[model samples]
Target chain A: MKKTLFEKIWERHIVDTLPDGTTQLYIDRLYCHEVTSPQAFAGLRERGLKPFRPGRITCVPDHNVPTLNQDKPIEDPVSRKQVDTLEKNATDFGLAYYGLQHPRNGIVHVVGPENGLTLPGMTIVCGDSHTSTHGALGAIAFGIGTSEVEMTLATQCIMQRKPRTMRITLDGQLRAGVTAKDIALYIIARMTTGGATGYFVEYAGEAIRQATMEERLTICNLSIEMGARGGMIAPDAVTFEYLKGRAFAPRGAEWEKARVAWQNLYSDEGAVFDKEVHFCAEDIDPMVTYGTNPGMGIGIREAIPSLDSIDEAGRISFLKALDYMGFRPGEPMLGKPVDYVFLGSCTNGRIEDFRAFASIVKGRRKASGLTAWLVPGSRQVEQQIRAEGIDAILTEAGFALRQPGCSACLAMNDDKVPAGRYAVSTSNRNFEGRQGPGARTILAGPLVAAAAAVTGKITDPRTL
Target chain B: MRNTFTILTSTCVPLPLENVDTDQIIPARFLKATTREGFGDNLFRDWRYDESGHPRPGFVLNQPTYKGDILVAGKNFGSGSSREHAAWAITGYGFRAVVSSFFADIFKNNSMNNGLLPVVVSPEFLSELFASIEADAGTQLTIDLPAQTLTNQATGRSEHFDINAYKKDCLVNGLDDIDYLLANKEKIERYESLVTSYKLQVTSK
Candidate 1:
């Protein structure tokens, strides 16, 4: 049968097809973090069984680990125990670990790319939802649960049901002032979060063709928000170029062979998809989220929409969103007060993101009433920002450059918006209280984050 | 305890929204501890409990009439950060399964591997389940794993569901990947030795 690249990889990984039409899939890699692994390891211990493919499983401590402290034991007892447990589990289980102060230690997603562990035509699973961040390298990556973490650790393969496929092709040059982050927000806004349900989406377009790897990751990283099981882009020169000199990439003559193999990872012409959506990049602007969901967003210039225009069935949804967000109908999101501004996460926290923010905030100070925290996604990102003078620029502008972690994005650590405070963030989700209880988050790009810091309002970066 | 797989059809509580995230399932505040117990009570903690930790009257789970082991949710259930506590809370709270038109990749995998079934039904079937659950909170459903069908005994209608064969095998036989590998340790040892020898050959070459 004719197949897409997705089909070929999936077919190669299929262990069996069940009586009920679900295929038993095999996992290639299992990535886990400190927070979710302890219970899973205990589950394994209770069963008196050891990991089957320890070499294929890797562990990292990110979520609960404070970004700043490296030399000392974790201050919080609970967090200390979580990190300690991961180190012990990884050690006892024979899995590779990037413990704190390990040169490679960083956010799991960032480490995956930097290590060349996320390769073309691979299946990657992590006990972290943003595992889709690995898909930027043309791998099929999805987040798994702690039990599935144990499953992969024990067997190196996870039982699975394949999702249907969706292809979202955006084919035009983007307008100025719009970055890949805007493109992703635009796609989610159009797709309504559930649009890609039960599907793995492949993003292909002229705009994507021009996007740097960081941008591809930014798009794929948010696939979960659009209701995709995950998202991927086929490997091309850009993929090979990014991997050529990486630490884990194939070397010498082997590199040539790997490139040849990767070239075959693209979707074939006339491939049939379960669903397809298209967008013209020209239509997208510097998009920012309005209500509590990633899907509830608009171009920066647009006003917050009134609920009346939607279908009657959607009125409750619109009203619920407004109630949760304390939003008024037909009000422009511009000049909306913000208590905080966050500039980090798996989304938009790379070196490019920092450069964008530093450029905007270099000469200007953060808004007097607002607290701006700029966190790098990885130590590498933080190092680059510091080396490139981005951190200095931020510091001079009254923005504190936080150490790297998934800080304030989900409030997994100390950085979180307090109850009833409004924040402008560059993270993926803006769900009600995603930053903290009753913490209303408006998702925007880094440029907009800087703008929110400077103006203390959810203003358009383009207008800045 | 002998590992047991009891096929249970959950009584549905209607949660009507797409993309219900992990934070909504079990908030971060409830996940602070390394231990997994006590979280079941705090499942959907902020939403389920009022500011003083009193039960919120408007919350769906608190509505006295809708009681059951299964939760039928709208599309994109369990979306957001990979918080396994969401699954733990659901399972700890005694939910045997979750029926949804779609489950986020991470949450579904977590649910299935942890012995909590994530039953994916067609949207049409999901709507029917929601309608039945809403119209009659006393609705009792049967999830037959061997049959791969979710049947509403009251309505006498069954929706076909799918589970991966390996998961089905393990679930029925109560064999996790570790248990299965242990049962075939000889083959694994041989494969490991083979990999070791292969590396030696490559290095020598």
Candidate 2:
């Protein structure tokens, strides 16, 4: 049978079919971070079970680690306890652990692909929604609950029913200054948050094929926001080029063989998906969210939708979201004042993201009223910033680089936007209080965030 | 870890807001704890309490007049993070089931795995549920897993819901992923050997 990329990888990992009609899927790699793994480890301990294959698992501490002062102990007792517990659990299980301050330590999703731990045709599981980020490498990856995390740890497998497949095809070229982040936001806004529920999406067409691996990762990282089980891009020459010299990637002869296999990873010509949607890439703009949900976004130059534009069932929540965001219908979002600008997350915290931010703020100074947190996705990315002189440009422009961690994205650590303040963030979700208690977050790309940092308010990057 | 759910009938607490994300269900600050047991105290912590830890008077969970084991929330409940802690918080706060017009895929899966039912209904039926509960605080509903049906005892209204047959079976038997996988150990071993042979053939060539 002709199959899509998702089905190809998924079928290769099936261990057995249970009487209950769910597939027992074998997991090739399992990534764990401090915030979600402690309970899974505790469950394992309660059952007196050790990891089925310790070598298959990798652990890190990111969400709860402070982005500043890595040398000192975490001052927040709760954060300190979570970090300490992950280290202890890793030690007890005899698994590879990249604890805070360790060179390998970084955001779990970033660490996976950069280290070549994420390979094509593999089944990856993590207790993080951003696990879909690894799908850029042509893997079947998705998030699991803590119980599934424990199940993967004890058996190196998970039970899953097959998800229907959807193909999202983007054609045409994206205009200059528009980015992968904008593409994601634009798609989510049109599709709404629950549009892709119960489906695994395979992103295709010319625009997706032309995107850089980093850009593809940014796109796939937001799959969960649209309620897709996961999203994948087939491995092609670009995918092989990105993996060629990485640490955990196959060696010379093995690489040649693996490349040959990966070449066959695309969807068959006659393959049929359960559903299909197509969009012209030209329609996407520098997007930003005006309301609490990520789906409540509009083009940077467009006005917020009027109440009459929304359906009766949605009018109430639409108004409520506007109230929380301090926005009004028919008002342009371009000149709204911003108190903070956050330019990091699994979605856009990569080196490419920093370069984009630096390009915009090279000679301009950061606005005095604005406070910006520029964090790298990994220590490797931080080092690259210095090597490439992006660090100096940012510092001269009145911004400092923070250590690599999941900072301010969800306010798990000390980096939090004050309540009632407006922050133009490059993170994925802009749900209510996602940054901090009562903190208002406006989701945008790095270009928009950089523009906000320089102007101290929401301003179209094209205008700047 | 809790009771095996076959049929559950209870009054409900209503949160009429749409897109109640995981962060709002249980904020990220509360996620740092090593144990899952205490999350119940902080469930809806920001909305439930002020900065000084005082209960906010306007919150539904805070109102003494409303109490139940089921939470009838607005559309798209649990739409943000993949934190299973959200499910822990809901279950810990004594909710056996959450009824919504829709649920974020991961949250629904997480709820089921943790012995919490995520009962999805039609949007119109969901609104009727909200209206019924608002009219009388004592409105009761019964969820029958075996029959895959939900009935409003107050208004004599009923709705059919869909759940994965595998999940329903697991929930009714109280069998987790580990338990079921362990039961199929021999089949899994056979499959592993087949995969190993296939790999050996490719590498040898």
Candidate 3:
């Protein structure tokens, strides 16, 4: 039988099938961070369960670490304890941990790809929801819970019922100034966030084929937002090229063999999928989220949707979101003033995202009181941005590029939004209290954030 | 240790909206409480009440005749942030199972491990189930853990569902990750002693 990539990998990982029909599938890699891991480690301790495969589990303290200062203990005790706990758990379990002070330390999602620990033909589980970020490398990666964390720690396996497959083909050449982030936001807008429920989305077609590994990661990162088990892109020459000298990837002779196998990772032509969504890149704009939910988005030039314009069910939520955002219905999102402009998080904190922001902000001064913040997703991205002169461009533009961490994305560390402040972020989520208490977030692309930083208003980056 | 699976076929209440998020399930403001207790009262707290905190007469849960132990929500029923507080509030509110056409990756995993059954059914089957449930609030449904079947007693519709082999083992056997480890205690101790001895010998050499 011609099986999907998922079926092939899942069958390969199946250790045993329980009587209840769930497969006890073996996990190849387990990535964890501080926020959800302490409890899992405690569960392991409670049961006297040692790490089943300690070597494959990599720990990083990203969620709770302060992005501004990396030299000292975090000021918040709760955040500090979470960070310290992950360190102790990793040490106690004899697992590799890139602690807050470690040179390689960064967000679990970013570090996995940067270090090549995420690769083709692997099953990766992380406590963080953005674990789908690894799917860009052609791995089957998804988030796991603390108890599932305990299960992976004790047995190096997870129980998973199968999910239907979706093949989303977005063909055609992308427009200038449009980005992978825009494509992602556009898809989220069209899909209405739940369009691909109960399915693993396989992204294909020419646009995805041409995207950089970083860009592909951005696409896969938001699959969860659209109700997927996860989203994945098949491995190709670009993937091989990106992983060529990475830290954990196969090298030399092994690389050739791996490449040969990866070449065949694409979905077979004429293969059927449970559902298919087709998108043309020409119509996609540099997208931005105006409301709390990512799906409640409009094109950068479009006006905010109001209760009067929407259906009955959406009216309540739409008006509620508009009220919370202090945005008037039918008003244009462009030229709306911003309190902060954040260019980071796993979504847009990569080197390419930085390059995009710098490309726009070059030779321009940042808008005063905008509090422009740029956080790279990983130490490598931070270094890469500096080497590429992007950091200088940003600082000259009045945006100070901060250290790599999940900074203001969630108010875990010191980077928080003051009450009633509005922020334009490149992160995946815009949930209430995601940035801080009463801090409204509008999710957008790096270019949009750069434009927001320069204008202190939501302007179309293409125009800028 | 409550291994006797009291399989109740839940009277499904359809929350047909897509992208029902964590905030909608349990409002974020209620997260200030240090413990998971008292969250049940606030499950879908915003939707359950009017602007003045009075019960919304139209809300399904507050209806005079609706009584259910299961909730059947639309796709992305648990999308958004990974707050285990959603699960706490849900389970505390007496929902033993949440059947959905789809669930968020984090929220589904969180639900299953927190001892709440997160069941997935075909979208077509779900639409039919929703129709039946909406017809009668006194609808009694039985979810048989052993057979992996859902039976609507009122409608005489018996539907089969699929669960993961390992999660089914855990949920049905009442064995969590820690319990699974304890069950393998003998093999674990044997492996530990062997590893310890090998380490000591290498150091001595």
lDDT of 1 at A36: 74
The candidates, ranked best first by TM-score, are 2, 1, 3
Evaluated against the true structure, the overall lDDT of model 2 is 0.89
Q: DockQ, per-model, please? A: 0.36, 0.48, 0.20
Candidate 2 deviant stretches above 4 angstroms? B196-205
TM-score of chain A of 2: 0.99
Error of 1 at A174 (Å): 1.1
Q: Could you give candidate 3's per-residue lDDT for residues B23-94 as a string of tens digits?
A: 678754554343346879988876787546899887877886767778888766788766676887888988
Q: Write the per-residue lDDT of candidate 1 for residues B116-143, one digit (tens) a residue.
A: 7888988888878778877888888899
lDDT of 1 by residue, A99-138 (tens): 7777667788887787676788888888777898888888
Report how far off residue A68 is in candidate 1 (Å). Answer: 3.2
How would you order the candidates by DockQ, starting with the best?
Answer: 2, 1, 3
Evaluated against the true chain A, what TM-score does chain A of model 3 have? Answer: 0.98
Docking class of 3: incorrect
Q: Report, to 2 decimal places, the DockQ of model 2.
A: 0.48
lDDT by residue (tens digit), candidate 3, A28-65: 78988887677678767866768877877888888777
Residue B151 error, candidate 2, Å: 0.6
> Which candidate do you rate higher for lDDT, 2 or 3?
2
Q: Is candidate 1 or candidate 2 better by lDDT?
A: 2
